[model samples]
Target: MPNTTQNAPTNVEEIATSMQDTVLGIWADFVNHSPFLVMGALILLFTWGISALAARLMDASLRHSKMRGSLRELFVRLLSIGIWITGILLAAMVTFPGLTPARALSAMGIVSIAVGFAFKDIFENFFAGILLLWRFPFEKGDFIECEGISGQVEHISVRQTLIRQTSGELVIAPNSFLFLNPTKVLTNLPRRRITIITGIAYGENVTEAVRVIEHAVDECRTVHKDRPLEIFPQAFGASSIDIEVTWWADPTPVDVRRSRGEVVTAIKGALDEAGIEIPFPYRTLTFKHPLETVSLEKSEGEIS
Candidate 1:
């Protein structure tokens, strides 16, 4: 037996009818607001186009300026960000006619603290990057050593810097880390001084050794002739006395390496040609009573 009541709808039917009505209501609202929505979207698209055009124009206008390439890029990026932020606010207001400036300000104020906490590191890095671009000594293509990482700076962005190491590895370092740490810019000058230690036998003439080293290092192709070479007896060791050889070379890693090799080879060859001895570790042991001597004396006594 089945009981049916036409006046009462089942729960399932009621739920479906409610959903249908809700969807139709939403469709009607969308239709009524389609024009404003389209206008908002078009405004955003136009803003994007303008932002891009302005970036190009700014880059071209400042191409010949004295500002650094990274600084120029920063300016372009900031301009784009400003334009987009304005565009978004305009679009939102147009999309929602009821969202007034005062209401927007209230909403932003409510979330300001939370947003700041959430993006604290992001903002810190952004400001640090700006400082680095504005007045920091090192720039793109400059080799810098910060903390334990050292490499040539490839790019500087709002949040991080890309360093390309001599070994071909790329390191992404935060701008804050670079900003806070002590950075040594190896390429700050066109040339930098490099020192290497070499040793000679105790018997070698100190004056002759110094003279030979100076001549050899100076003859190297990469040695900066304008800068004076320094060769001095640095310290005395167990095996030999260490000679500190210092000269100026090009500040690039490859140039420094090549110059070092050349200097070392020249020193070794010069020392060897001059009949000077390079020191090596050696040990001389004198036993109080050698076994061979004792045995021989005992045999002689037995024979006697």
Candidate 2:
């Protein structure tokens, strides 16, 4: 009765007109506050410039400090982040004068929780790396073993550690793994003990062999003299007697190998000169009963 189709068009027109008016009002308000907006933008730009300058100065200061490389980098990065965060907070305040610093910090805390959950592993490794750098467990160039990987520490970054393995492989290991697991710092001590098992004939004198091995280890230039050399009879093998020879040498892998080689050569030469046989595997055969001579003859007659 009231021209329903015409009314629908009118209603749609009314809605569109209302939206347009609202948008125009908002634009008018923005124009009125243009001065404040301009000032806020200038403050943000100034803040960014100041932050950059401060970060550069801090970086230069840290570089000249006597701190370790990893520690220095960590401090520099943290300082830069702190400066930027402060600048951003100041810029935010200038943009929204009604937003209090306390309220903003509370909002940041809430946001940080969400971010933490999202990047759980990243934060874990970051914190672990910080701990490692602080504790000074092992420095660069030190050989270490962790989680079945053995290598020399090439570099320790914030997220990962670079290790150069003995086999010439480069390993990028997560910092969390090294922090959470048991890590053996091979180069922490001045020297490490190396053990070698050598054998001699059953007829050789055990005391004399021990003496010879000890002398050989002592003669090695790479072997450390501070620690006592140990040579003990370990076990009796099928062909020869086994002796465990342990000696302390330089902690480095190269020195360990060189010292072991020299010790072996010296021991072999001394033993051979003394006429002591380094025995090989030997077995003797015996019969329970003597064979009858008629057996072969009877077999041959049967075949014929």
Candidate 3:
């Protein structure tokens, strides 16, 4: 076949020689540009040092300011990241004069979209934490309620909020839950109004009962004297008339409990001294016929 088999060995040898030449050329180029690689490494090291120093300075400044802990950390982290990224970009440019950071960033953006979808919950919490830190909805030591969680905020972090529940349980709540839902800042106001419903016998004077309750609440030291105390006849209960007593007090759980206790005790004593009865839930039952009579009639009918 015209020495085809003999020519095949020559073709194979040529292919091997070509690959070897390509590898050697690449190695030669790398050796020739070794200085640039060394410079890039030095630049990267300098960048890292500068970034760290800047972060420390930022932390010190933030500590002296009135900024919140979480917010200060956030700013410091962002500053460090920006410094490092700029440094790396400069180093890359030094290493490869023709390298395009913009083009690389565009490629990274496309990859980021896929990563975002895969870690949706993680990113959601991260951004939510950032938002929470930015907006002072509630701060550490503030009592708040969200999604059935009632507690004082212990600490706010980048991913979650640490809540110390009134029951003494520590809850690590995700930031997304607090941000997405409606949060009640219980201690936002200087004073909060507390209401207690007390019922008295229907025979008691409504006007007199109101006076007694109001006077009792006014006597409580914890009750805010500047604020108005209110008492109204809410409704007639099954066995007593319900009176709604409300008074303003310091917006704290401990104070609320103490004030309420004192007010209740005062009201009870005042009502008792006035001979007003706080009636118990009483129901009267009336039967058309006694069980014994019904049973006797049934027995007589069966005999008949």
Candidate 4:
């Protein structure tokens, strides 16, 4: 510290000189190591190209296999993922010849664990969605009731299933829940039976009412003629005779519901046109207590 030389370079000048020497050293190393560097680069490039080409070919082949829609989509995604992962690993090995895949994977284990834990739910959903897509428990345009909601399936994707209800509401349900829970597919059968309950006056003939219902069912356009429709007397109520009419519909729930509405309206109109009396409950009130009887009398008087 006591020695002073004006000719000695300042700290800034010394740092600048050291930087220049470091740059020259790096350039020399690069020139000397060109072969290895070029070789690694070329290997990586070749691996990437091959992986991309293989993934495309596999996807095309799977699409042509005429497999189920869900299975085809899943196979394509899985094949592409596998190819890219393998290619990246190969590229990493080529970039660092001394580093093995085992070592690299081991080093990355902790980070992978942390990431997995952080996104565990997301991973669960993703895997469950893949399973659902592959297995295809349900398909597009199927009438399914799940998670306390009943609707026709509009679309299905990896994350959620879209459903449109008769009330004009769109429901988006998670694929994971659909995969885990029970799903009711109404459209699985070629046709579904529609049940309608109608009542007639107390004195009306039960047999005649059943005949009228049968005629109405046959006349309704929604009723499939291929399937025999059933109309019969079910029970004799206190004030009316209950008649049941059932018909088959080929469409999904929404269509069935619409057709059912039309059929019921037509049946009711036909019954009314035929002078069939549909009765409601007619009750005669008897007073249980004296005070209740007096209140009823007073209310009727006040209304008058």
Best by TM-score: 1
| Candidate 2: regions farther than 4 A off | 19-66, 282-304
lDDT of each: 0.90, 0.86, 0.89, 0.79
**Clash list (residue pairs), candidate 4:** none
User: Which wins on lDDT, candidate 1 or candidate 3?
Assistant: 1
lDDT of 1 at 42: 100
Rank by lDDT, highest first.
1, 3, 2, 4
lDDT for each residue of candidate 2 in 44-105, tens digit (9 for 90 to 100): 78767876787678778877778876677677667767877786777677667798999889
lDDT of 4 at 167: 81
**Candidates in order: C-alpha RMSD to true structure:** 3.7, 4.1, 5.3, 5.7
Q: Model 4: per-residue lDDT, tens digit, 1-304?
A: 5444653557668999999999999999888767767777776677677767876787778777778777776776677667766766666676667879898787568777998899887777778878888888777778888868888888777777788886889998888888889888888788888888888998777777777778877887777899988887888777788888888987686668787898888778877888888998877678787653457888899999
For all predicted structures, in order, the TM-scores are 0.85, 0.78, 0.75, 0.71
Worst 10 residues of 2 by lDDT: 69-78
Candidate 3 residue runs with Cα over 4 Å from true position: 1-56, 59-74, 91-98, 289-304
> Over the stretch 146-175, how does candidate 1's per-residue lDDT look in tens digits?
998989999898889999999999999999
Query: How displaced is residue 200 in candidate 1, in Å?
Result: 1.6
